[model samples]
Target: MKNIYTLFICLFLASFTNAQDKFLTKNGTITFFSKSPMENIEAENNQVLSIVATKTGQMAISILMKSFMFEKALMQEHFNENYVESDTYPKATFKGRILSFDKITATESATKVKGELTIHGKTKEIVIEAQAKRTDDAIVMSGSFFIDLADFGIEIPSVVKNNIAKKIEVSFNFDHKPYKK
Candidate 1:
């Protein structure tokens, strides 16, 4: 009887561990805003793929460069052709993990995520104050932060330098389902 009870406890713990190991998102959005005195530009990528594997502490996120839609066509063209060079660098990706997962509680609503963001082939360390909420069948992670264009090798033309903000606000809303594999 004792052995059977121990086995039941182990199975329960194992199920929880498996539940926390993976996350999937089918409707994820990443949005950014660059405000200037002359004009404010806002863009968003609705089809974003993000995965967070808690067991390995591995995270991978990617967004198609062309997915970013701007209100102004000219601005969008220039962004792809010049600053971002979307033709060559077609995707933005980040490969990192949460620094301290052991200290995080499964039922907690918010936690600090410390990881690295790679954009334009440059990696930068970023700490995001994020919130993780668990639903009936999914886990949602959301966060907002700012990044400097220069830090990612994105250059602004001197002619329009003042027209763009140096730092841009970025926000992420991800609805993640459990990964089976």
Candidate 2:
């Protein structure tokens, strides 16, 4: 009877250790900026879902297109109905790995990430330079990258093309806690 009890305790401990290697959060934030000579546009979304596997350096992020908020309702409507077609493609996602995973320690470190970004039903490979810091309870990751609007099948109207930049700057920040279950 004692031997069986010991075995159960060991198994439980092992499972708990493995759970510490993964982190997740459902309220990450992602922001985008478009700056041109004519105008500057910006939007932010705080309903981003993200996960990081520390043991393998794998990461995934998902954000609802409609979650992005703009200062102007007209701009938001145009962005959803025409630019992004949010009804058809409701989400954007990124799946990739952090390079040199083993070197990431508790201190803040600079790293490179190679991943595939999917937006508007199109996928493209992208590399981003990011900063990662392991806190006492969470791993905070932040980065910015530029993406061409045309590459994602996002077309701007000719009349307003000058108002939008050809390339958009996107930045993200995620504080991931150990995922339970």
Candidate 3:
């Protein structure tokens, strides 16, 4: 996801220049779980790209739909080809700002971030609760939220309707370091 990093850096750089005002992570982690009566599906993607603008407490994240690694190959194939249609819509993105921008410090605290989240070609405005910590050299954020499939217009076939949960639990962790030239 070098291109994602480059693209995000360019987007953020175009607006600001101070390295300390920007924090970046090329290897953030995101995981999703779908619990069903018949089966439980889980996948993890460690190649998440994220950028945080400390000056404004603005954050942006990008995840490739196909980057998720499932335990079963068939599940991954079905997820890409049928569920998410990764070829048609390859990326899920979030652009948001921390509510208590000035309160973030070395001590972690419960925080609220509001922004637009887009997946499968659908965009929804959401507010997510997260624990945020900021220090001189690093900023860390972690949180979990649930999303309804219908909101994204992701349809599950009747045949496999019972195999997947209607609501998926998504979790994310991003550790950002100070940017430099």
Q: Which candidate is the best by TM-score?
A: 3
Clashes of 2: 0
For 64-145, candidate 1 gives per-residue lDDT tens digits of 7788889989988988998889888877776666555545444756666776787777789888887776554666678899
Candidate 2 per-residue lDDT over residues 35-152, each given as its tens digit: 9998799999998877777777888777789989999999899899999999999888888899997787778899998999999999999999999987548888898999999999
In candidate 3, the residue pairs with backbone N, CA or C atoms under 3 Å apart (3 or more residues apart, or in different chains) clash, namely: none
**By TM-score, highest first, what's the ranking?**
3, 2, 1
What residue runs in model 2 are displaced by over 4 Å at the alpha carbon?
1-18
lDDT of 2: 0.84
Clashes of each: 0, 0, 0
**Where does the lowest 10-residue lDDT sum fall in candidate 2?**
4-13
Best by lDDT: 3
Q: Write the per-residue lDDT of candidate 3 for residues 109-136, one digit (tens) a residue.
A: 9999999999999999999999999998
Question: Cα lDDT of model 3 overall?
Answer: 0.92
TM-score for candidate 1: 0.80
Clashing pairs in 2: none
